[model samples]
Target: MRTFDVPSAPAFWQDPHSFFSSSETAQGGVFASGDGAVSVLGFDALDQLGRNPALDGHPFPAGGMGSPGLDALLRWGLFALTAPEHQPLRRAVAAGFGARRIETLLPLLRRAAVEHCREAARRGQADLVHDVAAPLAGLAFCALVDLEPLQAGALVAAVEEIGRQLSPDSAPDGTEAAGQQAEAVLEMLRALEAAGASPLMRDIAERLPPDTPARPADLVAALVLDSIETMTAGLACALDCLLRQSGVAEAVAADRYGWPLAVQEAFRLTSPVLLTARMAQADIAWQDDIIRRGTTVMLWWPSGNVDPRRFERPFTFEPLRPQARHLAFGTGSHSCLGRQLAAMLAEELAAALLPKEGQRAIRIGETVFLQRFARLPREAPIRFA
Candidate 1:
């Protein structure tokens, strides 16, 4: 029941693990910020909280961003939808990425990975972030949505611009930036619709009832906006883990099966997504107090993965450790729908980047942190042989 201000200090972002590991956060597993927002920590606690109906997926608050166009686009996206409305849309989107669809795209995904990795090898030194991870994510996303590979760079750039509006530090920077990004998305969606829609978009449209409020293009945009950054960051993180840990890359290179374990461990150690927000729909009882209706609940996911109670040597990156309970892709109905595709891309990239016998990549600079997320620099050079 103690009210602590939300952790927004620069120092906190610089070192979130310290706060998560402290007794203060671990004691009750929940802390209330002065603004009535509640932050829930730990894997077990979040698993339990996710099942409670009172806390539903959060929506982008109207007028909060000072850009009506941007706010509208965000609100209409899948992340803002609730129950009844949310389930059908979610199912439709999931169906679009069905096993057959991804399986068919496997060769293409592998080819893209190989191409990027080959280019990195040609240079003998490359920035995996922009040169490899970003393009891989962008191209994979394009393939999923039936967009041309040529559009990948533009789409990726637009999504990055859109993402800036979602950050906690985001402030009203006038409507110009948000509006431009919104228009760019609308333009792309219109083009896709004109081109008779991608198979995924068509599947989504066919699956939903004619009366459903969501447009197929909106769902595609939602997926792109929500997933691309995470995918790019995840690949970069996994590579960073391999480079820092030593021998892991060679182990994976020798046995493709090890890719899953290494990728999962990377996710556990540094989740691309640090937190998710839920809104309390009604007054709910806590251990000794109440979460009033309309209060925002923050689920610090990375903290849960690193919780001392759940795993032995939580901070250490042990690829062999069981990864069953990590909240990397989150839990419950809103868990990542594109997780399979994301994992496949990472595995394929790893396979291509590390050969059975070749010089390995060495990090040229320290990994950078953007708030709680592990974001690589635009050019975090890595030498390869």
Candidate 2:
């Protein structure tokens, strides 16, 4: 049995295959015997194991007991709120967030991103995560959801807090605070439903089957919350990659095509969501391992992204790689709804901020990996002459 020490906290930020690669293992499986779970390290392995409903069940972690049933309530509430039932809502929302919508928004998004970056440049030093990425992502999400600026910011903060609370190391008080914030956001959505202010909600209301119990408010609220949380994390991860890669900043300035491809590579490399969890519905044998019914499986996307078998020179950033298949937004039935929008926003921000020749170093300060940012400093001493 192979043994590896597990990090105290989930090392979503760290490269998991750094210590050991599946090629090194005697058998195909990257078994962390100490961690008591099999690591799906390759894209093929991930494709087979990650989406297996019997193995990998749902993305959200199983709820903790005795929390006023807050997690369950939130899940059910979201399911009840989106339009055309849960499954249909997923399909329609995906359609709405298609390539067409993203293409249309590119110009406007690019303008906003550039202006924001210019403002940051003038400041000499700014938190890239907070000042640039966060705001840009929040605004992009708002545009997609038709939310007002101030309301979008609030929603961003609340969703960020929820992500923070999911961390194993979060303080009890902080977790409680996040729950309250999420509840408040839900209340706001409920109020919006009552007032009939949002056209998206109205569209959903009109689309639902006559017998469906799902409400438009529930769907809208769930999408809003999910979009802000995931998009913000994606933005931060993309910025971190841009800062780390040599010449990427200058490349963004020089070539328009460079930034978009670079953003895609970054997304492929630094998958913001570390692992997705799923509960087993039936007994299954995966490779040499037997996964019994009711066992929880974790599909590790970060590990899969770096798997050498799947990605050639996985650690190296190759913007022009011809074939790049990444699970950053997930796969199959649970794939992210805002993927195109998220990609557009990230690309636009990179193009805007990294351009303008002779900009100073973009520094990243303390960041919480998958949680809220403590600080992200992007300093540039600009000479307008």
Candidate 3:
């Protein structure tokens, strides 16, 4: 295995914009050094690397805590469900997210968005991250997985715990708690499978061929874990953007597509998954740097997204800026599976909050790098008039 040096202070994991700004050379080049490889990509190079298969698949390092033995479970689940052996099962699951299915669910999503706003209005002052964003994300996940609406909150909490456990500094007690939660979640999945109820469970059961070797519990666990972590982080980032932007909340309420674009822009700026790595299949030269066949390649999504050479006024939050290609959801086979769902949630949440005017402006009180939120105060005191 090729050895790579850990980044001393990775801006992608902390403040992505500052990282790019600091790394910019007088010649308009951005130098990236990590994992014993030094490569420079012009701001515009993101298109070539992010979209093109030849350059986009480089593996990058993962920041933060390692999941305790759960990574294996995730890999196994993905292989069993999406690999060639499970094509039929994959196709079946995809049907639930088909155009018709998503269309059918749009009304429910709108209602949920309205209800979330009503509840927040009742509280007057609410923690936007926990009370609003979290529940909104949870509901989106529930829709994707076909879980009961009432169970979304608990399921989201369990998934958040799993993500927290991935942090390297998690104490023994925290780890123990996470394990317990995981077990409980697994048990719930088992119970759901046994009951043969719930559209999601029934669809999964019916679609997965009898001869397939994938277990229901493993599949459910993977879905729940992946759904929760990505959705929560994405929603938090989206909310952060609305709080920073002027009139975005109102625009979202007035226009259906307005907030979704803003959310996408935020995703580009604050890539939730900072670094991803892939082992080189063969020796390749990247802009004069030779990457040997066995080397592990790391792709920096945040850096690539904001390269001044690529994005005009890269630091500014201009949602209306013409469509710019970004690596927020990644590319090729490894691209995120739930990009559409994330966009939908961001749009709905922004729209819902727009009507409650005179609410306190949202503020992020304390932020810990790589951690979702320590405290996000949304002291929006409001009443539904």
Which candidate tops lDDT?
A: 1
lDDT tens string, model 2, 1-385?
3443443434423444454365633354444433344444556666766565455324343466224324633563322222224466554455445566567767778888878777777776666667766777778766665667667678778766765665555567676777777677777777877887766667667666577655766666666656766776787778777767888766666664476688889988777666555545578676766766655445566666777777788889988776687877766455566777878788777766566565643654444443222211222122211
How high is each candidate's TM-score?
A: 0.92, 0.81, 0.76
Q: lDDT of each prediction vs. the true structure?
A: 0.74, 0.62, 0.58
Per-residue lDDT over 91-187 for candidate 3, one digit per residue giving the tens place of the 0 to 100 score: 5555544556556667787898778777777766566667776787777766755667798888878876776775544455576667667777777
Measured with C-alpha atoms, the lDDT of residue 39 in candidate 3 is 38
Worst 10 residues of 1 by lDDT: 371-380
- lDDT digits (tens) for residues 87-135 of candidate 1: 7888888888787898788899999888788878888988878888888
Candidates sorted on lDDT, descending:
1, 2, 3
